[model samples]
Target: MADLKDQRHPQYMGDRQIVTDLLGTTQPSDRNLADLARLCIRYRGFQGARDIQADLLKVLAQWHLTEEQLYAKTREIHTTAKVFATHNDGRDDWA
Candidate 1:
């Protein structure tokens, strides 16, 4: 077996695309709930998936915001920040 130092410290098991998919279907269903829960647990303390985890929790917590409120807020955080990208005229979708 490989030593601890030799082993790869993989990033958290979640990604932004999955988070967006889950957010796309925010209904209170078993699959959605499970996915969100899994994300929260997987990204408990890791900084890489911090925003991804927060987005999951925001839907799980049911904040009284409009339909696109959460997505809009998070989307505004440009791609350079490693969040996600938007294909709008003024955004960097290639980041």
Candidate 2:
């Protein structure tokens, strides 16, 4: 993938750096990046584009995200976490 540093947007550039540190040559795509970006915004309640990009970079760098048949799996995970937090009152007692 092209160097994320080459991206114009400040958020995109930061994310690219973080993702590169985290995922190396496997920088995330528009779709996955978008979802991950959105989740960061939602969870952090105004996590500017830079923050979203940073979070996405952390996630990608830490995971072995598959390249084929990509989907919003990260978003789903974020959604599930939100639902779990809402329903379980931020506790693990519900199991």
Candidate 3:
């Protein structure tokens, strides 16, 4: 099983790309933002996800994302993660 910090997870990698593209960054990649989104989903079944969500919101504020936009994107990521978790039996299948 891939750990939360493991960006090699397909779901995490996808989310990373989504966030990177959304932020419109042409510079070097930074995993912090994407990692936060990954963690939010990785811990979806636990309170940890909430903590991560709060942290992500704080970071998003700095990025100037409107509340509606943030909510939509965050909700989308969370839903995708939930679906992935459900279908994969709560384990990431990178094999």
Candidate 4:
């Protein structure tokens, strides 16, 4: 049988680095790294949504807006963008 350690996928290796960087750990245990890699690959769109969500919450708090309010504002912005696009010949120049 092939050795488990030898079976580490390239994507998992890349994810291991991302996991370590996000956790601020240089050398996490093999098991912990494997678990993180698996979780990132299998769920949350293959990215660390947990940490990103926390950061987004902090930004929202700093802006003094609730989650629902943020969504409402985002929708408003998109609607405005569509109007602008119509005026600009269907070109979305706003990034």
Candidate 5:
């Protein structure tokens, strides 16, 4: 076991390309992730997905938009998925 300070912080976990490529389906690429997020907002009737898209747009317009934006956006979508998943499972918890 390694000390917390000596352990790897996984700086690459948030990388857009890696997440996108690793998923290799819903998002095989960063651009695809962004596009899918947008499409979810445009088509999906899920409020969570819509909110995720909104958050993504806000982050993107911050002058640092890039492939990373897509990754970040997808994570946001995942949050939505979690929320809906819980709700569907008969739980009303969400913030």
Candidate 6:
């Protein structure tokens, strides 16, 4: 498996950087964590996007949020993010 922190998908260059920079910080603000949660849902079901998936989950854990809680946030993300809203399909059932 690729190192989650070391691998970045080209498709999400700018989006990944935003999340990565947030992760690099020791204490991300709630708003930043909300951004991470939105991004986490945004990448759901994408192939070769495990790095971002794992990274998002890792940060949630680091901040002491459960996976269930992280996923719960996905529904709101799906409702709000245009990408997730428009991309709904079998691949995005996680939300």
Leading candidate by TM-score: 6
TM-score of 1: 0.44
lDDT tens digits by residue: candidate 5, 1-95? 95434222232233334334334443144444554454434423433333344444444454345646555877876666542222456543221
Q: Model 6 residue 17 lDDT?
A: 82
User: How many residue pairs in model 4 have overlapping backbones?
Assistant: 0
How accurate locally, in lDDT, is each candidate? 0.52, 0.45, 0.47, 0.43, 0.43, 0.65
Candidate 3 lDDT score at position 38: 50
Taking the tens digit of each residue's C-alpha lDDT, what string does model 1 give over 1-95? 95434222154333577677777774644444444554555666554555676786776557444435544444444332443224568843221
Candidate 6: residue 47 lDDT (0-100): 63
Cα deviation of 23 in candidate 3 (Å)?
Answer: 16
Candidates sorted by TM-score, best first: 6, 1, 4, 3, 2, 5
> Which sections of candidate 1 miss by over 4 Å?
1-14, 63-95
Better of 3 and 4 by lDDT: 3
How well is each residue in 1-95 modelled by candidate 4, as lDDT tens digits? 95434233334544445554545543433433333333433433423345443543444455565656655555555555532214646643221
In candidate 6, which residue ranges exceed 4 Å CA deviation?
Answer: 1-11, 70-95
Better of 5 and 6 by TM-score: 6
TM-score of 5: 0.23
What would the per-residue lDDT of candidate 6 be over residues 1-95, giving only the tens digit for each residue? 86545334555776768768877877765456567776766776666667778888778777777757755755555566643234545463333
Q: What are the clashing pairs of model 3?
A: none
Prediction-by-prediction clash tally: 0, 2, 0, 0, 0, 0
Instruction: Provide C-alpha RMSD values for all models, in order.
Output: 12.7, 11.8, 10.4, 14.5, 13.5, 7.6
TM-score of each: 0.44, 0.28, 0.29, 0.36, 0.23, 0.54
Candidate scoring better on TM-score of 1 and 5: 1
List the candidate 3 regions with Cα displacement exceeding 4 Å: 1-28, 48-51, 66-95
Candidate 1 residue 2 C-alpha distance from true site, Å: 28
Reference-based lDDT, residue 36, model 6: 71
Worst 10 residues of 1 by lDDT: 5-14
What is the Å distance of residue 57 in model 2 from its true position?
13
